[model samples]
Target: MKTYYKDFLIRDWQPGDRNPAAETISTVLAEYSIIFEPRGADIDVLEIETYYQETGGEFWVIEQEGKVVGTSGYYPVKRGEKSVEIRKMYLLPDVRGNGLGRYLLKELENAIANRGFQEIWIETASVLKEAVNLYERSGYQPTTGIETKRCDRIYIKKI
Candidate 1:
């Protein structure tokens, strides 16, 4: 599915999107002093179909000027009943502070809920203050469990 937001376009991962999407995510992480672990935590960004689609999930990319600048995706997890964990949500420096992050998140929630998911979980680092605030403002409650080495906070929202 494709969604349009002003001059930006939100769409599913395509054949050539993997590298650019991974670079966008890596660049965003670097801005926060977080290392991008492509073969480790970020392997999904490299193998979208294997890790996301094969597990009954999806990965999306945001594009502007025909170039990818942001990425977000989710996959099924065993933490909660019919739950999916939101992962790899990163916005490039160019797209920051334009309300695009919130828009993408809302779209993710709607899509996940439409898929009959009962709960949505997010794991992120406190260094990303904007992300933490976004989750709180979006009604995601604080929770325990830091599965990723770079992440220190987890939040859950029931749909």
Candidate 2:
């Protein structure tokens, strides 16, 4: 599926997108002073589609002039689960505040809802105030009981 937002094209991630997607994510992390630890197992941007597909999920990339600028995806919380978790939602600083994040989120929500998901969850760090604000503005409420050393905030929205 392909979606057009101005000059950007959003579509399901292709095999060739791995490198660019990874680079985009790495760049954002570095900008935020977030360390990339291979042992943490969270830097799997290169295999987004492969990882999400096992659970009937999907990864999408937004590109401009054939270059990846943003990415997001959703996967089931667990096997046969009705709840899904949003992952790898990131965009370059240059593209921020242009409504592209909201667009990407809406598309992910639609895809999750179509797959019969009842709720959507996202984990983020408090350092990312913009993302937290976006989630709050989008009707996601804070939730407890999830503890992660790296990610301190958790939000949930029922669809």
C-alpha-based local distance difference test score of model 2? 0.83
> What TM-score would every model get versus the actual structure?
0.98, 0.92
Which digits, one per residue and each the tens of the lDDT, describe model 2 over residues 41-143?
Answer: 4545656655787778898889988889988888888522488889889999998988999888898999899988999989898888888899999999998
lDDT of 2 at 47: 61
RMSD (Cα, Å) for all candidates, in order, is: 0.7, 1.9
lDDT of 1 by residue, 22-140 (tens): 88998998999999997898988999999899999989999999999899999999998899999999989878898999999999999999999999999999999999999999999
For each candidate, what is the lDDT? 0.92, 0.83
Error of 1 at 127 (Å): 0.5
Best by TM-score: 1
Worst 10 residues of 2 by lDDT: 36-45
lDDT for 105 (candidate 2): 89
